[model samples]
Target chain A: MKLYDYVRSSAAYRVRIALNLKGLVYESVPISLLEGTQLGEDYRALNPTGLVPSLAIDDQGSGEGILGQSLAIIEYLDECYPEPALMPATPLKRARTRALALQIACDIHPLNNLRVLKYLTGELELSEEQKTTWYHHWLKQGLSPLEQQLGGDDSRYCCGDTPTLADICLVPQLYNARRFKLDLTPYARLVAIDQACNQLTEFRQAHPDQQPSHPGENLTRR
Target chain B: MKLYDYVRSSAAYRVRIALNLKGLVYESVPISLLEGTQLGEDYRALNPTGLVPSLAIDDQGSGEGILGQSLAIIEYLDECYPEPALMPATPLKRARTRALALQIACDIHPLNNLRVLKYLTGELELSEEQKTTWYHHWLKQGLSPLEQQLGGDDSRYCCGDTPTLADICLVPQLYNARRFKLDLTPYARLVAIDQACNQLTEFRQAHPDQQPSHPGENLTRR
Candidate 1:
């Protein structure tokens, strides 16, 4: 199995952590979104979405079935490798976990993704400051409600003591938040939860600076 | 079963359709989002997120337990009542089905829902045209990809001949699109699929016009 990844992509980061948590060995074939590597003809055929974290499986014995979208790929991985279940067995519990995950994946991440930001600056003609403003606006909207939902009085993770699907989502979004220097202070509880997560090796390895392309240069303070 | 709903919310409409499809009898308690009913003291205790379509089940011998997001609530229903399976059995197929459902639920609907539009108009102070532009931008971005991802050539529905979780999501979104007067010509396949769903008694009965508090009698289209 080969993963088409962009080091800085948070969605890819989530999959990396998931893979590590499951102790899965997979080859990382970096697709540089910054250098237009994803838009190359070879990559486009592999993923029509032209997005990062495309998993190409030679399960067809010819590397024909390429899966795009991080969540889909992760679920695919969970199915194929079923030991450490990313999702719970009960449907209600699974739904809760997915909802929490979607809280980040759908509600928060998609809006602030590299493509959307590019769309803002390119098509909407938002100035640099305006783009940042747009990003932070969504960050606050999504996180504010989230804070209210899972504030200071919650469990060790989003669901409970065990790190479920929600934590997998939250850690990356927090990384993005710190990258943007959006005040993490507002979400006091979430920040605390994130602090606990950052201490672990799985999340540590998935940090953007740890990636191959992050270049031994100025790294965003986490 | 009791459903906390707004007659006009498309998310609520989806749950209602699912319930009706399952032939489950549920009592409707309207939370008028337009009139700030959801923001009141009573509703706040039920859903901290202040979102509608919270379901309460009394099988646990208490009315206080059940509450949360539409997808979560729908999954609980699917688990509790397993006769007509909304999701397929295989893990890969289920992930594909869910990815399709969430392409609408997480990506498209959340972006254009009442609150987001209001934020665009009221807070961002975008013009009506700009709001529509924001609305259609995401709709087109998400839907075009979804239309492509949908292997409609092989099946009448989004996934196959059976109306899986994807169809439950797609039918309501198309209803929203037609209401928004967005051009449907670009998505003949999606329209054809929705038409197939519309022919079903379950989907037809779940239409907004068929609901109890439908405003079609009092207020005309904007």
Candidate 2:
């Protein structure tokens, strides 16, 4: 198996955490979103959407094996490798877990993705201050409600005691929020959950700074 | 089951379609997005995110049955009602179907959702023309590759012969695209799939126009 990956993409980071939690080993092919490597003909042919973290499985040499969209890919992984399931056991809890993930994935992440940011600053010609405002506005809009949802819950993670898909999604989004310097104090529960998840080796291993292609890595190796 | 819904919301429309496809009956309580009904205390108490299409399910006296997020709600319904599966049989095929759906849900729909458009025009002070341009830009960026991905596929639906989650997502997005006057010619494959899905009673009954609170409905009755 091989994953077309980018170190800093929240979507890719979600997949990396899931893989690590499942104890799965796969080759990580770095796709440089910064350099527009995802837009090249070769990557587009591999993933028509031109997105990172496409999981390519051999599947015993039968049918389409490449998958895109982080949540979908993570679900696929969970279904195939049921041990340490990323979803809760019951359907209702599963739905809640998924809803939490989608709240971040659909509502928050897309608005702040690299391409959309480029559209704002490049095509729309918004100032950097305006762009930062756009970023914080979405973070607050999404995370404020999330903070309320998680306010009273005392689960070790987002959905349950173990790291489920919700936690997989939340950690990376918090990482992005901190990178943008959004005030994290408002999301105290989320911060506590992030701190708990980071204590796990799987989550720590999936951090952007730990990836091969992160800017902090050695230039020669990268 | 009760659905907190808005007639023109793509997310609510998706849940409506899923309910219809699963042959499940639901009470549609309209939350008018235009009138800021979703922002009211009543709606937020049910769904803290202030989003439409929150499914309130009485799960045999189980806890936490209210499900938010269209995909999560649909998946819960699919799991509970397995007669007509919204996902494909195999894990890989299910991944493909979900990837197709998420391509629209995360990438296209959120960018063009009501709040984002409001942000574009109200906060950023973009002209109507600029908003339209922004809408079309994302449509092309998202749908062009989707068209190519679906180009040679002969399935009656997006993932297979029967309508899956992919088709459920596609119909509403195309509805929004046409509303924005996007050139459907560039997305011939998606347009064709949309036409095919619309032929079914399930899809047709789920239309925004068919909702109780649709603007075309008599205001007094509403």
Candidate 3:
């Protein structure tokens, strides 16, 4: 299997974590989102949305078996590889876990996505402060509700003691949030869960800095 | 089961269609989104995000088994009642089906939702034209990729012949698109699918106009 990935894409980070968690080895085919490689015809053909983090399954010598949408791909991975389940066991618990994931994936992240920010600064011609405000607006909007959903539960991860889909979705968004410099003090549970996730090798391996696109460049940035 | 629904909510409409398709009789408890009822404290307890279309299952005598997020609710319904499967059979097909559904549910709908639109007009203080542009911008951005994903497949619905999750998502989005007066000519496949879906009683009954909140107003408006 090969993952069409971008270092900075949080969605891509999700699949990377899932792959590492399941102990599946896959070649990373970097699609430089910043350099506009995703807009090229070839990548567009593979993924109509031209979004990063498309997993291509080895289809028994039938060429690349491409799949899109991080959640869908992750779910597929969970279904295909059941040894370490990404989802919970029961229906009700699964719904709760998925709802937590979707709260960020759909409601929050999409609004503050890179393409959306670009549109605000490029097409709409909003000022830099305006763009920052827009970013923080959505970040707070999403995080506040997420904090509520997680509640005061004493679970090790987002949904349970074990890492599930909700945790997969949570870690990436928190990483994005810190990148934009939003205040995380309000979301104690989320911050704690994120800290716990960071200690894990799977999540650590999938961090943006570890990606081939920008190898250990956190030093260069600082 | 009782559904906390909003008549004009695209997300709520999706759940309504799913319930109808499964022939599950659910009591429609209309939560008026336009009236700001969703923001009230009581409703917020059920859904911290203050979003409509939450399904409450009567778990015997264990109070209301509330579930939020349309996709999660629909999946729960599909899992509990497997007579008419909402997702495809195989993992790959299921991924394809979910990818198509998420294409609309996450990407398109959230950006142009009532809350987001209201934010644009209220906080941003944008003119009506600017607001409309914001709406159409996301509509085109999402739908264009969707058209490509659907590819010239002659399926009656988005995934396959029967009305799967993709079709449930497609119908509401198409309805919203028409409301905003976007040109449907560009997405021939989606338009055709929407037309086919409308012919079904499940889809027809879930239409915004058919909701109790505003009944027969389609005729009164004329």
Which candidate number would show the highest TM-score if scored against the true structure?
Answer: 2
lDDT (Cα atoms) of all candidates against the true structure:
0.76, 0.90, 0.86
Model 1 Cα shift for residue A137 (angstroms): 2.9
Number of the candidate with higher lDDT, 2 or 3? 2
lDDT of 2 by residue, A1-222 (tens): 788988888999999999999999989888888789999999998898898879988764465578899999999999989999899888888998999999999999999999999999999999999999999999999999999998877988898799999999999999999888898988999999999999999999999888865555323222
DockQ of model 2, rounded to 2 decimals: 0.90
Which one is best on DockQ?
2
**C-alpha-based local distance difference test score of model 1:** 0.76
Local accuracy of candidate 1 as per-residue lDDT tens digits, B149-170: 7643758888777777789889
Off by over 4 Å in 3: A60-63, A213-222, B60-63, B213-222
Candidate 1, chain A: TM-score against the reference: 0.90
Would candidate 1 be rated incorrect, acceptable, medium or high by CAPRI criteria?
acceptable
lDDT digits (tens) for residues A159-220 of candidate 3: 88889999999999999888888989999999999999999999999998887555543332
Cα lDDT of model 2 overall?
0.90
Q: What order do you get sorting by lDDT, best first?
A: 2, 3, 1
B1-222 in candidate 3: lDDT tens per residue? 989988888899999999999999988887877678899999998888898889989654445589999999999889989978888888888988888888888789889998888887887778889888988988898899988778667887888878899999989998888888898899998888889999999899998788765544333221
Candidate numbers sorted by DockQ from highest down: 2, 3, 1
Candidate 3 clashing pairs, residues 3+ apart or interchain: none
